[model samples]
Target: MENKDSKSEMIKSMAFRLFLDRGYDATTIRMLSRAAGVEAPSIYHYFGSKKGLFYAISESYLEDYQELLKESMKHWGADPMNQILGFVKFAVWYTMNHIDETKFYLRYRLFWPAELSEDMEKHFHKTNDQKEDLLRDAIRVCIETGSCKVDEQTAYRSLINFVDSCTFNIIFSNWRPDEQELIETWQLFYQSRIKLGKGDFEL
Candidate 1:
C-alpha cells in the first residue's frame, strides 16, 4: 500500500490536472476519485471537501515555490541583492518547468473566479505572507546597500507587476521563450528597474 503521504499526493496531483482541464464546477467527487485512484470517501477523509482540497493544492504548490526561492538565495549568501536575484532565477525556472502550476497560479491571481470560496481566497493570500515578508526584508537591504533606489511600495508593486507580465508572452500567448532567453529578459528588467550598481548585471 502506498504511504499516507503518497496517497495524499496522488489525490492532489490528479485533482490539480482535472481542475485545470475541466472547470472546477464540473469536476465531481466521483471524477476525482477515478482520476486519483482513490475511493470517493478517501477524498473526504484526506481533504474535508472539494474546497478543502483546492486549498491543499494551492498550499502545496506555493510551499514548493517558496522553497525554490530560498534555495536560489543560497547561491551567493548574505548579499541583499542576491536575495532578489534569487527570486528572478526562481521565476525563470518555475516558468519553464512548472507550466501547469504557473498557469493555474496566474489564473487565480489575474482572474480570481467567483467559484472560489471566501475561505479559500483568504487562505491563498495568507500562505504568501511569509514569502512576501522575506522579499520585503531583502528589498530593504537592497535600499540600504544602494542597489535599489526605489521605495518599498514601488519596489514591491514593480515585482508583482513584473511577474504578472512575464506570464503574458509565455503562458497566455504563443511566445515560447527558451530558458536562456527568459533569464536574459528577467535580468534586463531587474537591471533597468533597479539601475543595478553592477552596470552589466547577468543572472
Candidate 2:
C-alpha cells in the first residue's frame, strides 16, 4: 500500500491532469480514483472533496507565483518603475511557461464553482488582493518619488489595464508574444501612462 504522503502526491498528479483535461465540472471523484488507482475515500481523506483538491492544485501554483513575485520584486530594481515592469515581465514569463496552470487558475478564478467551499473561495480572493496591493504599493512609490507623471490611481489603473490586456491576449490566443513584442508593449504602456520621456526603459 502507498504511504500517506506518496498517496497524496499521486492523487494530486492525476487530479491536475484530469482537471486540465476534463475541466473542474466534468471530472468526478470516481474518475479521479480510477485514474490514480486509489479509492474515492482516499481522495476525501487527503483533500476533503473535489473543490478541496482543486484548491490544493491551485495553492501549489499560487504559492510558487507568490514566492517568485516576492523574490523578483526584491531584486528587480530599487526603483518603483522597474518593479512595475518586473511585475509585467514576470506575468509574461509565467503565462508562457505555465500555460496550463495559468489557464486552469484563470478558469477557476473567473468562473468559480457554485459548490466551492467558502474558505477556499475567500483564500483565493485574499491571495489576489494581496498581489493587487503589492502592485498598488509600487505605483504609490512612483507617485511619492515624482517619477510617475500621473496620479497613483491613474497609474495603477493604466498598469492593470495593460497587464490585463496582455494576459487576455496571451490566454485567449493560447500562447504569448515573443520577448521583443512583450518588451515593446510594456514600453509603450509605460510611456503612455507613467514616464514623461517617450524613450524605452532599459528593460
- Top of the candidates by lDDT: 2
Please list the C-alpha lDDT of all candidates, in the order they appear: 0.75, 0.79
Least well predicted 10-residue stretch by lDDT in candidate 2: 194-203
Task: Give the clashing residue pairs of candidate 1, or none.
Answer: none
> In model 1, which runs have C-alpha deviations exceeding 4 angstroms?
1-6, 113-115, 174-184, 196-203
lDDT of 2: 0.79
True-vs-predicted CA distance for residue 198, candidate 2, Å: 14
Worst lDDT run of 10 residues, candidate 1, spans 194-203
Error of 2 at 7 (Å): 1.7
**All models, RMSD in angstroms:** 4.2, 3.7
